[model samples]
Target: MAEALNNLVQLMDPYLLQILVNIGIAIILALGLNIITGITGQLSLGHAAFMSVGAFASAIITIRFNIPFGLNLLLSGLMAAIVGAAIGFPILRLTGDYLAICTLGFAEIVKVVFLNMDITNKALGLTVPTPKSPIPMPIYVWLVAIIAIIFSSFMKDSRFGRALKAIRDDEIAAEAMGINITRYKIESFALGAFMAGVGGGLYAHFINYINPSDFGFLKSVDMLSMVVLGGLGSIAGTVVGASILAAAPEFLRFMSEYRMLVYGGLLVFLMVFRPNGLLGGVNFTDLVLRSLGRKPAIAEVREKQT
Candidate 1:
């Protein structure tokens, strides 16, 4: 058994390395969307627009100016955040369905602009300059994972995250409690966009090719699906959600044309059976404790009190 296990590990090492990198990128995308729809109660279909903006912006800067990859990523995310803030001012005033439609419109507009823009080569797409030396995928993946962990941890514990949650649960009550709803919502939305932009920048660099079609409504929906399937408000759940959705298609390639049908059907089944998702907003730490046969600390405390 030991020898077999060692052989399996040796065989799986390279694939595992690649999967880790992919998971890091997926986590960034999923967690970013979580801040928007999961935390702030905003439905945005324009996340892909923000991502495209970031991807193109980073690619252009890096290609033209020969900037460092890290700087390119940061600047791209900042630009996307600025755009998000600019658009948020007008469209965020709309609520629920109105908000959704406005964001959808925004995404479409961004797509059309990219399609027509001469700078982007008029829909032919632009080639991103590859790094001079190949950085092992695992290293980049670790960097992204660290960034994601820091961001998720900060947002999960910060006052900003709490305010956003309040807005999600009860907007009116949150406002009554003296929370600045508009500011918080806009901030959350922009932050989400910023993360999406960073993810896009990484994606562009990794793939070294992109087109307007890459960032569309379907992409936004896919991100949303990750957030929902992982458990709306859970960061860990988002990672799991993204992994399953992203990797499942590849694994099901043997089915070919029926793959998508199976995927969709599986999603429907999951929604029907577990509406709250796999982890239902719980974190990995909590899950680990439960798996170790420990009850929730709060529950134990309540029992003691009784």
Candidate 2:
């Protein structure tokens, strides 16, 4: 099956294939950030730090331990989650800009650690082992992305998800209602970090090389941009936002050096027009259903409208 998929993928345009691959990875990253910042209303500025941890961890495991690819991915995510929980425990007490600053500091600390570590080859980075298997990279990337989406969707509707949402809306009120704010926040951080780590693992395999520089402040900003553009707490919006932003650089390549300028300007323009994001507080599912001339459940409609 992997071999056949690879053969089929090879027939497509390489550039387009690369873009799709990027979008898949971006979806994973964005969804992870969505859980922390979007759904939980935590302002995090160091998400790329988790990705860096995952990338390096996964690469090392593959290079030295020669573990199965699936195990490598799981271990990488677990490593990142563990780190997030550790960091989150001390800093979760801080709120608003203070929380953001601490997270940013944590990210910088992580980057510096990787940059100076001998096991990671210091500034030189690590080379991941190419999979001997014939599985198409996009297949692996998109499959994980689909699972993330489903997981996120389920989380949004579950009791656990509601508790997170409540905290996002009002921490004090949520605490009043018996939700353990600190514990929930830490869990959110861990969950988000796990996803980011998995994404980094996939990314390390796809690119086959990774250095500390790749996971920097800019990378974190890019992840935040996707979630914000897509719409906080909306999985559908994250998918759309991640796809557009992931593909924009390629589409804007014709502009050469001015592409980044255009990209920044585009984001500013969008924010001005849609301050809440493209689908903020809007029910994308209902919109799609309405477009198809089908009706969503009354309860869902009411819930979204509020």
Candidate 3:
């Protein structure tokens, strides 16, 4: 299968191939943010900061220490996860808009730190080494994206995932039920940051460059938009959202200035008309049952359990 994919990738047009790669990267980003804000009910505006941590960490190692790409990627994710855990301890206490403000500030601080640090080339940005043509990178990107989706799906069904859902639904009730809110919150944040960092590592290698500005608040907003517009907790919706959002810029390039206007207007329309989101939710099973004019078994069981 691997050999076949390689051969197929080799035959594809470079531009088309790169577009697919970009979508895959965005999928990873969307999934990471989904884990943090969507599933965990945390409003973070500093996700890009975590990505920068991974990017810069990977860039520094690749440039200075000459580590292998895979190792550098793992090291970068570990670095970001450490930073996430460190930051999550204190900030996880805050909620809603307050948390968002703190995270936005955190992103600025990270940007400034990278801009001043000589290790990151001091705003000149770090250039990652890459092949003349996009090759193995696409495969790596999609592999990670697939793994991320699977991980998210499994997590959504795991014991910890239920804890997260309970917290999202009612934090006080979850705490009352003996769930360790603090531990889970911090762990979720760290885990989300880890995924973002891994995505960043992939971005760095694929783009062959790292700029502090690239992972600014704007990037965070874009990531958030993907999750929110998809439907907060729907992984399938996230994939669709990432695909459309990632592809929009190129598809809209013809309009230039008007492109953003159209994009913003579309988002506004979606928010007003379909506030829950695109797939903003009903599980596939529920949708199917409703379409067939039957009650969902899960809902029946839930009602009975309640």
Candidate 4:
């Protein structure tokens, strides 16, 4: 099955194949942000900082240490998680827009630090080594994206996920109910950073380039937008939102210079017309079944709305 998928992917137009891979990367990044800002209800604007860390770490490991491709990815994630834990404790104390601004500052700091660091090679950037694995990179990205989606979904149904949601809805009540708000917040931020790091590692290998400019504040905003526009805390919504947003530029290429204007307008329109997002608290599968006049596999996630 794997070989067949690779062969089929090989048959696709190279640009289209790249777009598919891009979507997978977007899914991973958006899901990571969803964990932090959506499920955990903690605003983060420095997610790209984690991604930058992973990208540079993976690139450095690949070039200097000559570690195997897979190890590089894992190490990058670990590196990002460590950094996340380092920053999360102090920063997670802030809530709402204040927290967002703090994270944003953190992101800018990371970018500037990377810009000055000799190990990161300053602005020149590092070139990722070519993969030695037989599996095509796009396939690896999709597989990892699938794993991330499953992990996120499982987290949502786990005890920890419930705690996070409780804190999100009402931190005081959650604390009163015996939830360790601080610990859960740190865990969510670190785990989300880890996922973003892994996604960055994949992107580094896929693009074969890394620079501080690539993972700046704007990149963080894009990931956050994917989560918010997909319906916070909704896994299916994240997937659909990532797909649409990631693919929009390619689809709008015919509009030339107006593409970006149209893109921004479209997002604004969606926000205005559907404040809850495309999926909101609703399950995509449930919505589909309802449209088909059949019972849905999973019930709607009405807790947030109710």
Name the top TM-score candidate: 2
Best by lDDT: 2
Model 1 score (lDDT):
0.82
Clashes in each model (backbone N, CA, C under 3 Å)? 0, 0, 0, 0
Over 99-197, each residue of candidate 4 has an lDDT whose tens digit, in order, gives 999999999999999999999989988887876766789988998999998888878867999899999999999999999999999999999999999
Model 2 agreement with the true structure over 35-77: per-residue lDDT tens digits: 9999999999999999999999999988888667888899999
Query: What lDDT tens digits, residue by residue, belong to model 3 across residues 82-125?
Result: 99989999999999999999889988999999999988988899
Residues 1-306, candidate 1: write the lDDT tens digits. 545544554566675656665667777878888888877889888889999999899888877887666777889899999999889988887789999999999999999999999888768998987754334434655577677866775676578788899999999999999999888888988888898888888888777898999999999999889889989888777878988987877778899999999999999999999899877768655565689999866678899999
lDDT of 4 at 129: 80
lDDT of 2 at 147: 95
Model 4: which residue pairs collide? none
Prediction 3 TM-score vs. true: 0.90
Question: Which has the higher lDDT value, candidate number 2 or candidate number 4?
Answer: 2
User: 1 or 2, which is superior by TM-score?
Assistant: 2
Off by over 4 Å in 2: 284-306
lDDT, model 1, position 133? 32
Candidate 2 backbone collisions, by pair: none
Q: After best superposition, candidate 3 residue 280: deviation in angstroms?
A: 1.5
**TM-score-sorted candidate list, best first:** 2, 4, 3, 1
